[model samples]
Structure formats: C-alpha cells, structure tokens
Target: MAGKDRQITLRFLAEPADVNFGGKVHGGAVMKWIDLAAYACAAGWSGKYSITVYAGGIRFVEPIHVGNLVEVGAKVIYTGRTSMHIGIDVRAGDPKNAERHLTTHCIVIMVAVDDEGQPTQVPEWVPVTEADIKLRDSALRLMEMRKKIGAEMAAHVTPGG
Candidate 1:
C-alpha cells in the first residue's frame, strides 16, 4: 500500500522524567506523543480544526529507555463524514549503540469542526498510493475488531435484576 499524502514525523529525546523506574519510557508520555502526532496529521488532512473523540487500541510492543531518541510517524488512514482515523507509530534509537527500535503503535479518531465548534463534514480525500490502501485497511480492521469486542462485552453484561 502507498503512504498517505501528508505524513508527519516528530522526534523527541527521552529523558529521565519520560521513563519509569524500570528505565522504560512512560506509557503516558508515549500516549501524549501519539495524540499530538495524530492531531497534526488529521488536521493536515482535513485542513480544518479538529478534536479527538476517540483513541483506541494503543499497544506497546517494547519498552523505550531514557536517552533514546523517539521518532513518531503519523498519517491519516480513514475519513468519515466529519471524522478521520490517524495512525501513529513510535520508534526509538540508541545513538551509542547505533540501534533503532519499534516501541508502540496506536490509532486515534478525530472530527473536524466548524468555527462554532460543531462537527462538520470534511472534503473527500484524494488517496493516490498503496500506503493509503494499507492505512485504510488497518483502520477498518481495528474498527471491526473494536465492534466485535464491544458486542461480546455487551452480551456478557447481564442487566441488574
């Protein structure tokens, strides 16, 4: 699949404050970067102000450490009438060892809004590459997975008598 039109990259240096006692980077910090990067990508795609309505399926595969350089990549993956799905990938690098790592992945949903702060439909996106296809498929898969999980949870939640 081809990449999105406006891919954005954000890089930051991990500090002691950004990591946990175990030397692993804090999940909260990663989450914050994810949201920020996703916001930028979504806004770039929509060309309008947007607000995050949902952030789902943030999975951390590896722990990052202080002194590592964290790189965040953001892209617009899907679009609805007024909402867009943004995908973020986090990687880390240890300059001393010349090693790079993948730490986390996440997706966030944001909606475009009008000047009055009401939800507004976005213009049609022009997807021109295979990466866009991959992004679209990934978003659809996550959405379906969330829906199935929600249905199962609802089925198991017995109403109080």
Candidate 2:
C-alpha cells in the first residue's frame, strides 16, 4: 500500500464517456481521477481511509482527447501529524508511441482517519531520493502559501451572530 510505498502511478485510457462537448476530456472528469489518485496515494501511506481536505493549484495545460493514454502520477510530498499533502500530475499521449505530455497538475491534502471517521496520525515522510527532496521542498513552499491564504480569508469572513 501507499503508506509503505508513498508514491503511485495510475495509467489508463481516456474513454469517450470522459469527453466534453468539444470532444476533449471534461475538466470535471479529470478532477475526479485526480481525487481518486490522491486518495489512493494517501491511503497507502496512512494505512487507513483518508479524506481530501483540500485540492488546489489545478492547472489544465492541454486538452486530453478520447483514446489517449492517461497517466496520473501521485506522490506524498509532505506529511503532518494527521495529514498528507499529495502532488499529482496528469499526462496523456499516444500509447503506441509512449510519448506523454503534461495535461494537468494539482496538489491535494488528505487527512488520515480512523474507523470512527476522526482524524488520525500518519507516518512521517522523510525524503531519500533527489526527486523526493525536490518535491518536499515544493510542498513546503505551497504550505506556507496556503497558510497565508487561509489567514487572509479568515480575516475577511464574517462571523455568524
């Protein structure tokens, strides 16, 4: 499982059902795949069910056409006492040629949960490989940006009487 592995790659074909009116894969459909991939990655590392607390920085770089080979790469970039920040990149291309282009990318935060559905602690992630270290550093930068954004939102949110 991911809890022990910490990274996973999901590959499949883009079906026609995932296409939009413009004949390209729908954005919502792609997001669903991203969420599922992230969930799998988090659950693997946490050794328990996990819930997505946040999904951000989704960038759709190119349109995914029906019949293209799709690959969703997910990795646990950072972990907290009870949370894991997963980074995902979606790429699609010709399966026969084996060349893939980045179609979308995003970051998702998943929180491990116990049987009672409450948050639980996840094993810490220590970077070993150079790629892992680079991703961890990027995750740290994003975390800081998230904190700043949260603070700004909290200051503007009106309290209920």
Candidate 3:
C-alpha cells in the first residue's frame, strides 16, 4: 500500500478529565489514544479489523496539559504475514497557536483478525521514501530487541511468582 494510505492522525483537545494528580494528562489516557491511533492505521492498511498484540517503547517525553491540542499520528512501518508494526507519535501544544511538541512515542504491533478472531494475512507494506525506509529499519531493530528482552525476562521470572 502507498505510504499515505497506511497512516492516520487523530487530533483533539486534552480535557480536564484526562488530567492526573500531577496536573497533566494521565499516562493511561495517552496510551489509550495511542492504541486507538495504531488500530486505525493498521486496520486502514490491512483492510481488516486489527487488534493490538503488543505495544512497547512507550516514552512519555513531556507532559500534556489540559486544553492543549493533542495530536496522535500512527503509521505502518513494517508488515509481517499477519502483523503490522505501527509507529505512533503524540504531540501537544496550545490550541491557540500552531506550535506542537512531541509528548510521547511508541511502537505498536497490530495483527489483523478475521471474524472468528483468528490472525489474518495483511497487505505487505513497502517503504517508498527515505523516511519510510528509516522507520521500517527502526521497527526491525525494535523487534530484535524485544526478542532479547523477552528471553531475559522469561529466564528470570516464574509463572506464578
């Protein structure tokens, strides 16, 4: 699919209800937004209902204030037989002005699913631009790191303890 067709952006205002005790938007709220954006991008690219299988490297770089204009952008960076790696960026700024700063970033792995909830194949995503190529490479590196981290954790942790 073309790059433009494999991306989605959601923009909205951060509300007071989204604020945490620290006077900024709650981390959970931000994460929910990220998941929603990633789902939209993955489903759009795959043309099937997509479910988040994994989300990692979620960095809360800066606080998002109430009333700030929040933007969540998600793009398909890589594709496997059934999964799509979505890169998500969250930015926020004063709604009155045009400036926005990156507030969070993460990588989400979404798998397309059939009506029965079984994993379904998705259309392959090809990198066409320099940015796309770089993002795809980054996703590949993250996948490798995830494997190593998972192995290390499994070795040290017990199922019930």
Candidate 4:
C-alpha cells in the first residue's frame, strides 16, 4: 500500500452553528468530523467504499471553541480481512496563533464494501515505522478489551428483556 493511502487529515474552521449552549463546538459535531476523517482514511487505504462498523473510546479531552481551527487526523493502524481499524485524533486551537492541541480521540472500525454493499476484503496493513507499530499494537489491545467487555455486557442481559 502506498504510504499516502494510510492516512488522511481534514482541516476546517469550527463554525458558529457548531457551537452548543455551552458556547463550545458540540460533541456531536466533533463526532461527525471524526467519522468523516475515518471514512476517508479507510476508503483511501482499501481503494473501495467503506462504512463504519463500530466507533468507540471517544474521549473529549478539551472543549473546542466555535472559532477555533479544527484538524481531524485519521490513520489506518490495523486491518482484518474486511475491516480497517482507524485511529482518529481531533485537535483545535486559535487560528490566529496557529497552535493546536488534542481535543478528542477515538478508534473507528470500518469495513470495505463492494458495489452491492457486501463486505469486501482489503489489503492487510503492515506496520513499518515505530509509530505505526505502536498504533497497531494499541489497536490490537483495544480489540481484545472490547471482546471482553462485550462478553461481560452480554452476561448481564436477560432473554427477551
């Protein structure tokens, strides 16, 4: 896979319409941005249309102001037969100062799909750099944790409840 296909970054200004009653960009808006970036990264890497299968571990570290410059970065850290694990980082800060800091982070799972929307196989991602290896390991750890969490949650549910 080409190096450029593994990542994507979106930069834009947070609009006033994105603000919440608390006068900061709404959490939902940030989530939308994250989804958009993740999709772009997944599609670029897989060379096929992709859809989000799961998104979790979203942490809003800091409030993003309406006028702040927002950057959402997404990278494909791991791949399954049909799924890509994307690591997304959302950062925002004053546009004038040109300084930015992390505001949110999450992991999104995207599945490549064929024209009929069936899951399609994607090229496997192999980590080459130290950062890439670290992120891939992190994704693997998260996947294991999610499985345990899912089993625990299922144990608590009752039939037809």
Candidate 5:
C-alpha cells in the first residue's frame, strides 16, 4: 500500500432515482455510497480485496435532496491484524454552491481478504495526525459499547424469532 492510500473520496450528483417517495434521498442509497467508499479506502490501504464486516452508528443527521452534489469521504482511522476501521462522512449541497453540509457519518470495519475470500493480514497503520490519533482512540472506546449492543441483539434473536 502507498503511504497516502489510507483515504479515499468520491463525489457525484444524487440522482432522482436515489430518492425516496418523500423526495429525499434514500438512506439505503447513502449507505451504498458509504460502503463503496469504505471498500475503496480499505482496499487501497491493504493492497488487496477487503470486505465490510461491520458498520456502526450510522447517523442520518440530515435529509439529502436530489440534484445535490453528494460527497463521501472514507479514511482508515485504525487497524487490527486483518481489519481496518474506516470512518466515513457523507456530505451534500447544491451543485452550484461550494459549501457542503454533512448529511451522515458512520464507522465501518473492513477485513482484508485472500484469494480464497478468507481474512488476511493487512499492513498495520500508525496514527500520524492529531485527528487520526483522536479517531483511533474513539474507535477503541467504542469496543465495549459494540460488544454490549451485539450481545443484546443476539439475545433478542432466538432460533426463529
């Protein structure tokens, strides 16, 4: 992986087909963009294929309107043996306007994969900037909360329930 490959960005216009019946962009469409951006960042950093294992705290803070210029930014904030923790920000605004407002944010975990599609080791990432350090620490702090939520969700799901 190149030194500067840890971050990836994508920008495009939110099309009419991406909207919900209410005329706002669908959350699913945003999530799809997020996933794509995450994959690109993870793959670039790992120098191999990567798959999303988990996406946490997807916050849809604002509704996006069609024709808005949507931008998705993905960066690897932390890394484990085979997983890269990516933070994604989705922003949008009028194409004619330069200013963009954040619409959503999320944290996604992607695992590097081998030819057999099994988890593979990825190059470790070390924090360089202050922002990277803070984001990495934030990811560490979320582990306990994630475990609790996972356990609670698991308990709610019985064999067929």
Candidate 6:
C-alpha cells in the first residue's frame, strides 16, 4: 500500500456465478475482482478516472470456494507519467476456517485518462510507510517481469486482435 493512501480498503463477496462446477471460484473471476480493486486504488490516489493498461503477475495461492467472503485490498505503489502501479491482495474468509487465507496476489497498472480517452499525466504518489515501501518494491519487480512477458507476447501477435 502507498504511504499516503493507507486509508484504502476494498471489499467484495464471492458469489455463485463466480464459482466453477468444481466449486472453486474461477481465476478469471478473481482477476475481474482484482481489476476493480486496483482501479479503486488508482482512483483514490489520482482523485480522477483511471483505466487499467497493464497487468503484472497474478498468482493464485489457494482456492476460494462458494460462500466465501472475499476481501481484496489494493494500494498504489508507484506512479509514472499517467500510470500507477497498484498491488492487489485477495483473501478468502471462510466461516468454517478461523483464519483468512491468501487466495490471489497481483499488480495491476492503471493510467489516468482524459475525457477524450487519451492518457494524461497525473501527480506522483509517494510511499510514506515501511509497508508501502515493501509493497512498492515487490510491485516494481513484478512490473519488470510483466514487461518481459508482454514483449514476448507481442512478438507472437498476428494480424488478428
């Protein structure tokens, strides 16, 4: 979490439609949740509209079954011209289990856009706390990895979208 943005907390509940026949929530569903959480974090920091432009490492550590209460937290870690890197941590709080389990973790990059839908520069967000620093460092590393993967994917892109 970014230092000044410590006031951030985004929550969402896992629903039936989010689960697969296997009874576990689908990874794509979780990604959607992360996207929303990251957008909220970026919006909170930018105080304006932000759109996701890139996505970093998305790792699923545990299964989130149906009826689980999913709590996701996102915080801005770094900022560029108009882009902000936000760290997303998703946890599943099951009534059956006494402790919440970490389910998914990812870093989503969002860019503040103008009304015309072009990327626009925004103020940089500073990390104020140790936690924020740690998260930011992790996000930066993940960002590098994502860039490499993106380049690899681009090299294989065909004429089709």
Best by TM-score: 5
Pairs that collide, model 1: 1-130, 1-131, 2-130, 2-131, 2-132, 3-131
TM-score for candidate 4: 0.93
Clashes of 1: 6
Please provide TM-scores, in order, for all candidate models, with all chains considered together: 0.82, 0.92, 0.95, 0.93, 0.95, 0.84
For model 2, residues 1-161, the per-residue Cα lDDT tens digits are: 44588888999999989999999999999999999999999999999999999999999999999999999999899998999999999999988888999999999999999999999999999999998899989999999999999999898878993
lDDT (0 to 1) per candidate:
0.82, 0.94, 0.94, 0.94, 0.92, 0.80
Q: Give the higher-TM-score candidate: 1 or 4.
A: 4
**Comparing 2 and 3 on TM-score, the stronger one:** 3
After best superposition, candidate 4 residue 43: deviation in angstroms?
0.7
Off by over 4 Å in 1: 1-5, 96-99, 152-161
Q: For model 1, what is the C-alpha lDDT against the true structure?
A: 0.82
User: Cα-based RMSD of the predictions, in order?
Assistant: 3.9, 1.8, 1.7, 1.7, 1.3, 2.9
lDDT of 1 by residue, 1-161 (tens): 11234668988788888877677888998999988888788777778888998887788999888888888998777888898888888999885665667889888888989899999887555566897887788788888998889888898888993
Model 4's alpha-carbon lDDT is 0.94
Each candidate's clash count: 6, 4, 0, 0, 0, 0
Residue 97 local lDDT, model 4 = 92
Off by over 4 Å in 3: 1-4
- Model 5 per-residue lDDT tens digits across residues 2-109: 336889889999999998999999999999999999999998999989999999899999999999999999998899999999999999999998999999999999
Q: What is the TM-score ranking, best to worst? A: 5, 3, 4, 2, 6, 1
For residues 1-161, could you state the per-residue lDDT of candidate 6 as single tens digits? 33245335666568899988788999999998888888878877776689998776788999998888788888777888798988788988876666788989877889988889888887777677898888778777777877788899998889777
| Model 4 per-residue lDDT at 69 | 92
